[model samples]
Target: MADIARRPFLRHLRAETTSYVQHLRNGEVRHAGAGIAFWFRPATAALAEVPLDDREQTLLFHARTADFQDVTVQATVSVRAVEPALAATRIDFGIDPRTGRWRAAPLEVLGGLLTELAQQPALDLLATLGMAEALARGLAPVRDRIAEALAADPRLAERGLAVTDVRVVAIRTDPEVERALQTETRERVQQEADRATYERRAVAVERERAIAENELANQIELARR
Candidate 1:
């Protein structure tokens, strides 16, 4: 029998396109996908593939407002890879073939941190603290926990993925709470105005009484003379 050539099945695969990869000065990473893109501040067309070991890390966080019920927010986090040379061997962020989106193992670690933040008291989280600063403080404990988790992962340890920063983006506040605050402010202002009016009237009355007494004393002195 003559040798026959067998045809191989060809599967259609789509080529991936890269878009909106930002390397911020604060050692943060931002990869914007299809719906949105980042205009890299202070730089243009500087998008480059983060070496496997040096690729940025990303995390998703969810938080709820205590003052306002049913209010929740989602944040996307990205961190720069500490060791560029060992990135490929240490961290395996599976990039989506079609979207060129990068996914890191520490994402779960981020989730755990977010979980802790969500469980915290809402009043304390929002008290006198800027939303972003409060969130950063809340995530500090998680950052330590993430360091420990990454250290345990042999692959992660090789590339030194440091948790440099935790940012809280797209924070949401409750409409009802905002309205209440406004109302309270207006009431306070009105009260202050009313108090000022009473004080001015009292001063005028005292001045008028002093003038009348002076006139009476002048007439008595004239009569005595």
Candidate 2:
């Protein structure tokens, strides 16, 4: 990442293969592309570097379900700059001439953008479903819904960003709610187990009665003989 060296009034810039470097001199593009190096005067040149590699951002947020149940959503969104030139224009990917580092946090800006874009659809979808339904069918549906929303949003295209993948890691309620649900499930399982045990005992008793009756009939036959 140390791709810049300070020269006497000039700076030497080297770009990585994963980064798209744009060199602007007096409001015109002098050089642009990935993995290209150039020297420019510090006073007159503006440099912008946009990373083209895919990045995964972890997102955690809260949403309310249709039944007014509050749940936390954890997700990961994979994204990349599809058009580096346009991205450089949209976001402040500009780097200081002295250091090959961004003057501002461009990636953070992208993260905020992605978080908003991903959260809205999830909120809307969860709002339409109850907590049970959301927990039961939320993972795939939420992931797909977010993917669809990101893919269809024109803002991303205009900003030269694209969503590569979306994954819903977890949708969980509060600890108290979670414990209550767990208790309910556990009780249901215990009831089923008890029923099964009772049925097994009943079958054993019936089998024993049939065996005893058969033995008695055999003894009576012997007595008659």
- Please name the candidate that would achieve the greatest TM-score relative to the true structure: 2
RMSD of each: 13.7, 1.6
Q: Write the per-residue lDDT of candidate 2 for residues 1-225, one digit (tens) a residue.
A: 429888898888999999999999999999998999888898998999999999898889999999999999999999999999999999999998887789999988988998998899999999999998888778999999999999999999999988898899999999998898889989999999999999999999999999999999999999999
Spell out the clash pairs found in candidate 1.
52-87, 52-88, 53-87, 53-88
Q: Which stretches of candidate 2 lie over 4 Å from their true place?
A: none
What is the TM-score of candidate 1? Answer: 0.42
The TM-scores, one per candidate, come to 0.42, 0.93
Q: Write the per-residue lDDT of candidate 1 for residues 65-108, one digit (tens) a residue.
A: 33233333343334445554344334343443323445554445
CA shift of 43, model 2, Å: 0.5
Q: Candidate 2's C-alpha lDDT? A: 0.92
